[model samples]
Target: MSLLSFRVEQGDISRGCGFRSCCWTISRAVISSGILFRKKNQVKKGCSSVNDDLFVITDAPIHPEEVSAKVESRDAGAVTIFCGTVREWTKGRRTLYLEYQAYESMAVKKLAEIGGQVQDKWPAAKVAITHRVGRLEISDLAVVIAVSSPHRKAAYEANEYVIEQIKKVVPIWKKEHWEDGEQWIGDQLQQVEYPDGKPMKGSGTDD
Candidate 1:
């Protein structure tokens, strides 16, 4: 039986205490549905609780340790943290700095969705992702991702998977401030280009 698979009887729900009340202790339950019902931002254990996942699109400088702490769990034997920083150059062009922007609401939603996918694939893993927007100087931390799991392999794989998935799905863009001029990188992969010098239009205002 998977740790996430559990059936909360009607009586259990009526008690106002469901899966989260004993997240770590109910691993031996039956496997029917692989969903773990948890409070909106938290998972409770006994009398205490911690954020189940952290997903944010912020304008402030991101602290890696702070993001990592969100996923810490006594059941996790390994936690993998990944920090992405602005580089000084891209290809042969020298970059002075970089500016990042995102459709904040949707980007955050996509981040949480990615976290949910991670949990589905690695049931024992918990993930947190924080991406910074606004201007970033050389070597500035742009994104931080942390994943904790009962083993190192799942933690490492899940952390790498999150970053790649974010790039492919999240609506976050970056502009390179070159020595000569600036260009909006429509897609982080650089496959899509914006001739008008803006992010690709979509839902929500890019703030």
Candidate 2:
């Protein structure tokens, strides 16, 4: 498993412990199923070279260390890594598996866009993001974002910014393969279930 995969299992299980007591570990074991934003006052003209290290979509598992290494400069004192992994349950729903499909080029561009946004706020920070496409099993690493900076605060903030923007703008579709049924739905948490699990009108298809 990659470092990102490891961090995800560790962090999410810790969070799951709050939701479940004795079964917390089991609940986390099932994480085949499942942050913040900032304001942009102005538009940027072009993408940033800072993201050239990555901002990608791949079928292979993500390596968090590789992403983190992109920002590992002598100038960087802190590196904050955020790993988004596939979990077992979402809103009491039992997800057997998940299929992640994406408009690959579009998704990659959006990730680069997020990197540009991060540079706007935290100029000293460097970011690398990798989101796996195709099918992902429970506890699989879905996305891994690594941000490094001279200080820890900037790394943390930039890492969060990139993750949130990917959710909002990246043209990546995830279908929840649940025990009851599968649904190509919105929201990673399964909070928004459209009628018949189709995209909302004017929302476009998952095609």
lDDT per model vs. reference: 0.64, 0.60
Q: Pairing residues by index, what is the TM-score of model 1?
A: 0.72
Report model 2's TM-score to 2 decimal places.
Answer: 0.70
Residues 72-139, model 1: lDDT tens digits: 67687766667777667566778888888887677877888899999899999999888888888887
RMSD in Å for model 1: 14.4
Please give, for residues 1-207, the per-residue lDDT of candidate 2 as tens digits: 222342221232113210121100111111221201122112121222223656767777766655555555666766676777777887688878778777666677778878888989999988878777678888887777877777766776677677667666777667778899887755432234555765543243232
Provide the TM-score for each candidate, comma-separated.
0.72, 0.70
Model 2 stretches astray by more than 4 angstroms: 1-51, 187-207
Best by TM-score: 1
Off by over 4 Å in 1: 1-53, 203-207
Global local distance difference test of model 2:
0.60
Worst 10 residues of 1 by lDDT: 13-22
Where's the lowest-lDDT run of ten residues in candidate 2? 17-26
Error of 1 at 92 (Å): 0.9
